[model samples]
Target: MASKLIHAIYKDDDLVLQAVKQIRDARYHIGEVYTPFPVHGIDKAMGLAPTRLAICSFLYGITGLTVAVLMMNFMMIQDWPQDIGGKPSFHFYQNMPTFVPIMFELTVFFAAHLMVITFYMRSKLWPFRKAENPDPRTTDDHFLIEVDASDHNVDKLTDFLYNTGAAEIKLIEN
Candidate 1:
């Protein structure tokens, strides 16, 4: 049988938290949540694990450092060695100060560019991908709660939603 997704839309974050608290306290399964703006502590309340973005960020930073080192080394030592001042020679590691700017720029460059790419990939945002939104209004001013229930508990779910302060209730299929 195909699964059904029931979404209860709310306008306020506090109501969402309260409804989530009720469902969590009663041991109900929440499929997911959608919010326009991030509500602090919602993830914790939903028992979500911490993300590994930090690790990805570190790896991206290392990629930047590697690019910077290799590029500077190639230009100064291997490819085109140019003498800026007579006091120093055109050696890369020997003239470490000259590579500082490249290093800094690469670090920032890799972090920002790669971080965005990683985020988009992880979110499955690519060309021609079907959107996952149940309600278009959710992207602007609504918060959503998705619950899984069969015909047996649909009424109960809707009642709970109405009693819990949902602005609107709708059943969606995915």
Candidate 2:
């Protein structure tokens, strides 16, 4: 059997948020929501867990720091010990001050770059991926809530959405 979805379109963010809360309260499943931009507190309203991207960023930063330390140690101390201005480079600890800048830069670089890649991969936004927005207006000035209507009364759901301030409602089968 084809699954039916109700697209409840709203003109304002507050209306969409309120509708989402009411629908969830009424025990109707919300498939997804599309907004012109980020909507604050939407994740909590959608009952989504907090993301772990920060932990990934920290690990990436630590990896970069370790790489920087090892590379500097190998190059300056083990590979070629130089004596410029009588400043000995015999030990990494002794030349640690000079490597501080590189360490900091590498840590930030790794954290930032890896976080971007992680975000893209997690969001399934790989290169050349097709857009998934149900309506072009959602990318401009509209908000959309996709409610699951497979086992529900479509007329009642449509009426409920209209009562919840949906500017437009579309019934789609998938």
Candidate 3:
């Protein structure tokens, strides 16, 4: 099936943000926005739901912590029980303070790496993936807002986009 969309180009991030708010306030359905850099609060302006990446990060961190604890316990307490610098390795609880650094580092490592992987998966971004932006200029200096033009009057939408300070407008059919 083919669809029609209006691409509104803005030169400044602030203008794009304002245009997004105006578009939403005017009851227009925005398909997406492509910008050169992250615009703070653009997701809120677009009425997008909050992300759950933080929850994923927390779970990954817990997994790392558990692995660190188990590995430390097995290697230090169970596998080769030893006395180093007068600190006994017979009990995990008694020697937990010495393992704190490992636990913390592993937890952070897992959270950061896994969160990045989760974000890439969630965004469907991977190596050799084709770029989806309609305008390549959006990757450099411009911001583009894609509006669904299916059920709306194209002329009116163009006028609205112009009023919202769009530097350029294009109607694309897909």
lDDT top scorer: 3
Query: In candidate 1, what are the lDDT values of residues 1-174, reduced to their tens digit?
Result: 877878899999999988888877767788899998898888888888999988999999999999999988887778877777853545666888877988988998998899999998998898798988878888999999998875438888789888889999988765
TM-score of each: 0.87, 0.96, 0.97
Instruction: Go through the candidates in order and give the clash count of each.
Output: 0, 0, 0
Report the Cα lDDT for residue 123, model 1: 84
The sequence of per-residue lDDT tens digits that candidate 2 reaches over residues 1-174 is 999999999999988889989999889999999999999988888888999999999999999999999998998899988997788997899889888999999999999999999999999999998999899999999999999999999999999999999999999998
Which model, 1 or 2, shows the larger lDDT? 2
Candidate 2's C-alpha runs over 4 A off are none
Model 2's alpha-carbon lDDT is 0.94
User: lDDT, candidate 3, residue 6?
Assistant: 96
Give the Cα error of residue 24 in candidate 2, in Å: 0.8
| Off by more than 4 A, model 1 | none
